[model samples]
Target: MSTAPVFAGPDAAVPRHVAIIMDGNGRWAKRRLLPRAAGHRAGVEAVRRVTRAARALGIEALTLYAFSSENWRRPAEEIGDLMGLLRLFIRSDLAEFQRENVRLRILGDYRRFPTDVVTLIDDALARTAANTGPSLAIALNYGAQAELTRAARRLAERLPPEQIDEAAIEGELETRELPPLDLLIRTSGEHRLSNFLLWQAAYAELLFVDTLWPDFGADELSAAVADFGQRQRRFGGL
Candidate 1:
């Protein structure tokens, strides 16, 4: 539960993997006396900027927590706007992903989304599947607890309790395919994960940047990476 001490750097030595818990959109909008949807829309730009930054720097992977299962509790209009933005981003970014040589992969449950969004994401994933560059993984309709529960359920169905262990369960989780997460960023000064990538971020160096998601551009991200580069990742031992 302890966070790594804040470390500073010049951004040349960057971490290979960066995962983000995009927060503070609603608060950002509220402070402006605008609807929460406005902040959400602006956050999309931050996503693009951060992705571009990662790709330009030749980072191996960038995972974004775009939406969570708990988001369903929000009012209907906000939810609709969020879904609309998701579809639009997929459709529009399909070309950008290919042009930038970024591999796009949508993480989390696809079944819960509207049919149009589902198709758009499917097409986008297939279209950019050939790219072998920076991997942009977006988590939508995701909940870390839900992910763990699903993994546990799947494992439980295949093996008796006696046969399953930590390694086996980790393998069954969705984030298992990626290398161990190196850096985890959460915007808006929020200090907790809020059910983002529970299992994958076991050893990740956590960075809680104060910038709101919509305004978090490359410099802010670079600053966080600089901070991440200075910590001693002891994992579970000395």
Candidate 2:
């Protein structure tokens, strides 16, 4: 919504949890007459920039919608490029994340990933599991509806009917371990969630920006945070 560049001090209103729908990589590449892989690569750089900015901004958790379950429908080569980027990012950033105390976690059905990727993901998690810094959760093969269904199944298999309440379901959700979501942003001017964190965004303030994912940087992130600071969150109350 608001694209104004606003900055707030540490004492100002800041969201503890933030999520982003990194969109328009293909479009970004197409605009420049480049291969889609180039845009995906640039998007990875954007991810790095935003992650560091979020840490500096005192955000406790940052969830990035990297690969949705529906993303599998895209061309096989594009998927491979994305997976390659994921591997490179983890291998390249693991030590840096440990040094910065940035804990890493996966927010999706990682079981579907290849054995090598799953191993790397596990390694990254193991390395950063005890860090005491802002957490970065990458959503791979994730969809909120699928997550809800999986949680429901888990609850049904493990709990009695009487115990299946909101609290129980919330506990089963993957995002239960992270801070409650406060701000959600979508890039590329898209206004819809596209199967992102549906349940977790119950009271989150939404902001849509026209910048493509490859071009979004820390400044854009700060602008969104500033916009969030300017708004009042009633959470169903006046």
Instruction: Kindly list the per-residue Cα lDDT of model 2 for residues 1-238, writing each as its tens digit.
Output: 1122233334457888899999999999999999999999999999999999999889999999999999999999999999899999999989999999999989888879888999999999998999998889999999999999999999999999998998788888888888878899999998999999898887788999999999998899999999888787766766
Return the clash pairs for model 2, or none: none
The residue-by-residue lDDT of candidate 1 on 1-238, one tens digit each, is 1224333344335677789999989998999999888999889888888888887766788999988888889899989999999888887788889998888877789778898888888888888888987888899898989899988999989999999988888788776656567899998987999988888777778888788999898888777777776677666655
Candidate 1 overall lDDT versus native:
0.83
Q: Say which candidate scores most in TM-score.
A: 2
Residue-level lDDT for 198 in candidate 1: 86
Q: Rate residue 55 of model 2 by lDDT.
A: 90
User: In model 1, how large is the Cα lDDT of residue 62?
Assistant: 92
Q: What are the per-model C-alpha RMSD values against the true structure?
A: 3.9, 4.7
Off by over 4 Å in 2: 1-12
